[model samples]
Target: MHSFSIILLPLLSLLPSTISQTSGTFNAMTFNVAGLPAILNDNGVPGDKTANTARIGQLFTQYNISLIQVQEDFNYHATLYANDKHPYRTATSGGVPFGSGLNTLSNYEFTDFARVKWNTCSNIDSADCLTPKGFTFMRVKFAEGVSIDAYNLHADAGTTAADTTARASNLRQVSDYITAHSINNSVLVFGDSNSRYTRTGDIPSIFSTANGMKDAWLELVRGGVAPQAGTDALLCDNPSPNTTCETVDKMWYRGSSAVELQAQKFQYAGNMFLQENGDVLSDHDPVLVDFAWTKV
Candidate 1:
């Protein structure tokens, strides 16, 4: 019922391709569901969170998203869970005011599921302290003997000094955890990282500088070039399908000694999540990244 099961995937996918022992593919996504209670919902964001969340969950199966990380998955989580068919999903950590608002859904099996709270908090430009904001981690298996450490997080949001300090600590916490627990293991980190490389005072480089992970959007979409110095300049106000645009929703990945991983595509998924009235489902559009793996 609440997130513990052993659903088997296709036998063919479970085994590496015999023709090319290394060739395999999978896709991962991160979306902020904006599942705040009606009273907390941003008036600017149309449609009902409860209604949209169900559809959001349904879309994953429709798209065959291999794995998903959802942030702001607070209130209305049941509806999201009810509609999503993914056999591997994280149990909600209660709703906002009590939860960290982070969760993951996967088609493949995973283990070592864990949650970690940020060591610091602030409510300068945003109300980060109103809930137990933090990150979640797990080891997802792509196939037999093939597993990668995966993570989901919602960091402190704001631009004030207090906000930057807290966000810095948040990234450091994730980086530290990867260094300690996932060293030499393949890693796939995704979620709403509020911090932006273009924004001043953001430690967005910690993923690469500390964990040796590469940003999918930066490397595959931007040709490995960072955004020009600016204040998160490309934050889209509406659902945008352009993957080159800068955003807080991010994905970082790295391969291990036995398997090599490369980003095949980075997509900003939008059209599939729109409501009848053409309004987007959530405040943040999902980041979907396709990956190809081969034995090293």
Candidate 2:
């Protein structure tokens, strides 16, 4: 009887932990597709719209991406691609006219979707004025009753002080929006920040510290190798002939204590996504992050 009681107690203790373990995992990706006409006019790397759209579709299968955030998709190329390849049930494109080039694609159905254009933008670069650039917010369900607020953003691009300030403002807008609207404080933000983690006063640092969000890449270094601040992982348009490799694309998220989120893997999906002639899929390398949510 004593031996039977001991064994029964041990098995009972394991039931709670096993039942509370993570139910599933999902993968997310953020890429600046450079589909806007301005970027294409600058260089012909990605080539024709039809071919670029096809390659983008193939990447969804190659990476098994569950959620995607894309910037510079002003041409509606992302919308067409998502419809043809991915099984995304819900999607939202940035506003029209002076709409932001941001777009969010998700496997789960979206309960709510919205976009906010930055009040301030880069005055120095004429390209920045071409279209309104901002962030898109979406609510997606991952499990039976689990959902998260997802944000896709594209900040001002340029080296000038105005660009830096505009980028900071964009981060502030996103942070404030999530704080006020996010359900359960579970939020995921990803896109082309045009800011670097290595920079002292960058938008990434500001958003994380001020909003209680964590950078997925820094939290989970790929291959167990710690990345060098700026140069280790570069997601720029052109990798070759570039001395300083900067990480402009990023992913960040926040989850309540009851449900903690952890990044399982983080990497740049560049080599695999390329044309037969070796031309890249997009100007910027698509960044992938595999993460799981578990009960604490």
Candidate 3:
């Protein structure tokens, strides 16, 4: 089990609130749990891949995560992957051959859920187009009749140029849709973005642009003098460990609510199989964040 702690500081200029009352603070996590399709046959370790499903469930239960976003999935097959104790509703996109998919799980009763497919390319050089993938958007009602949007996204990955195009286009489609039909101003986007801020690309652009939205991690680092998660919570450091780096997985938020980010973390313990004698859990580590929403 991995543990994370966060220290919050007051913002000099507080942003305006959009909700009447925050009601309560909640935690959200994004993890690409290496799709546990029914057909996968684990070579060994911890009673094969099938046996590890329970451990996955236990992790979720331990975190008390209100919302979860994951990538790489097979609709019917993946449904059986989760334990019965934490039943959830999921939405899948993308096409066969390419495993790009999205999965969202929420503990709260979801008022509405749907998948929004954008666009993608199978190969940047090749003319073949790939299918886009995304997850369900839960309309969470806050105080003052305000609402927040929760979602997930998995963009096509590859070289900088290729990945950039796919991330931007797909993000634009989703952002446009949300801005059009969202019940409230607040929106939380999370999942495998596949592009980083230092890297030249659109994944960060689509979210950080003046159009609306801000990366939750970047927001946390704002005006903070302490060593925070943003500087240390690099999820995929196992493949090539270097003074803690950043990668695709990310979280974003929208709306004019003075949000005081309480905590943000990366969970990489028993799951950091590379360092744990190959007890491989998933390719990407989970990112979690806690926030306090102020109501207008």
TM-score (all chains, Cα) for each model: 0.91, 0.79, 0.69
Candidate 1 colliding pairs, count: 0
Candidate maximizing TM-score = 1
Give per-residue CA lDDT, model 2, range 1-296, as digits (tens). Answer: 99999999999988875663355788888888766654334335646765776677666666667998888776656444654455663344533345576766667677778878888787685357667788888878776546778889888787677777777787888888877887465788999988785554455765567778788766765432334453425544453333234478888888875566777777777665677778876778777788888755
How far does residue 193 in candidate 3 sit from its true spot (Å)?
A: 0.8
RMSD of each: 7.0, 7.2, 11.3
Clashes of 2: 0
- The digit string of per-residue lDDT tens for model 3 on 193-259 reads 7666655444465655644666665656443221232233543454434324455677887665433
For candidate 2, list the clashing residue pairs, or say none. none
lDDT against the true structure, per candidate, is 0.86, 0.71, 0.57
Winner by lDDT between candidate 3 and candidate 1: 1
Query: Judged by lDDT, which candidate is best?
Result: 1
RMSD of model 3 against the true structure:
11.3
Supply candidate 3's per-residue lDDT for 149. Answer: 72
RMSD of 2: 7.2
